[model samples]
Target: MDNIDRKMLEILQEDSRITIIDLAKKLNLSRPSVNERFRRLQEKGIIEGFTARISHEKIGKGTLVIIQIGNLKVVCHKFEEIVKEEKAILECHRVTGSDSYFMKAVVSSTKELEELVDRLVPYGQLNTSVVLSSPVSNRTLLPEDEFLHKN
Candidate 1:
């Protein structure tokens, strides 16, 4: 993608609901040009479907937990199938290294966390960590990222 395409992505990340006219103004391009680029971006699959960010705390899922599941060299799909049905699981990824899989989940209380742990115990050995606080999280991505820069 060109600089203009990159800029469009950066702007869209901030506010997906922005109108084509407003986006055109921000990018200093004509409405037709911006519209075409936006359409092309979607067609290319670079811009995935839009989604709303739900607040875990407000939704009664205040506790965030990271889970590492190991020793599932065979029958990985069995574990995957179970987690897919869990509403608490936000992300589950297959990773390289000592861990077979990594997952992020949210719970309302420790009781709920324990219940979740109980259900998954049969699949593999799990190493779970409860998050006390997240100083940096859910940051936007860019083609050229300056992750540490405020501006």
Candidate 2:
């Protein structure tokens, strides 16, 4: 992607709902050009999809837990199956080091967390921590120009 594409991504990261006209205005390009660029970004798989950011607390899932899983008796596919069945697991990462997987989970209470842990114990060893507060929550990705330069 070029500089214009990078700029478009930066703007869209801040506000995905921006109109083609508004985006073109910001980029100082025509509406048709902006629309074509957007279509190309999607076609090239540079822009995956758009989504809303929701508050876990507002959804009655205030309690945030980080779980590190290790020592798997079952296959990776089986462990993944168990994780998929659990509604509370929001994100799961295949991590390196001592841990096999790192998971972010949201629940209603400590009781719920305990229940979730109980279900996961058979799969592997688990080290869990309840999040107090996040100083930095979800930050958007850096512009492609900045990312490329830094690397």
Candidate 3:
């Protein structure tokens, strides 16, 4: 992707609802050109999908927890199935180091967290932390800036 594509991604990351005309104005490109570039980016899989950022607190899921699972004896697929069955697990990553998996979960209360932990105990040893506050959350990548500026 070029500089224009990078700019487009940066802008879109901030607001995916931006119109083609507005995006064109920001990039100093014609509307059709901007639209075509966006289409190409989508086709190339650089732009995966657009989604809304919701407030978990507002939705009654105020508590945020990070869980690190170690010493997993269950099959990977079985573990994945269990993870998928959980409604509270928002994100799960197959991590390196001492941990086999890292999961981000949201719940209403401490009781809910305990129940979730109890369910996961049979699969592995869990280390959990309740998120106090997020200083920086959901950061978007700017690969072009890194690639272009390297000297």
Number of the candidate with higher lDDT, 1 or 3 = 3
lDDT of 1: 0.89
What's the lDDT for residue 132 in model 3?
98
Off by over 4 Å in 2: 143-151
Q: Write the per-residue lDDT of candidate 2 for residues 57-131, one digit (tens) a residue.
A: 999999999999999879888899889989999999888898899999999998999999999999999999999
Give the whole-model CA lDDT for all candidates, comma-separated: 0.89, 0.91, 0.93
Better of 1 and 3 by TM-score: 3
| List of clashing residue pairs for candidate 3 | none
Q: Rank the candidates by TM-score, best first.
A: 3, 2, 1
Best by TM-score: 3
Candidate with maximal lDDT: 3
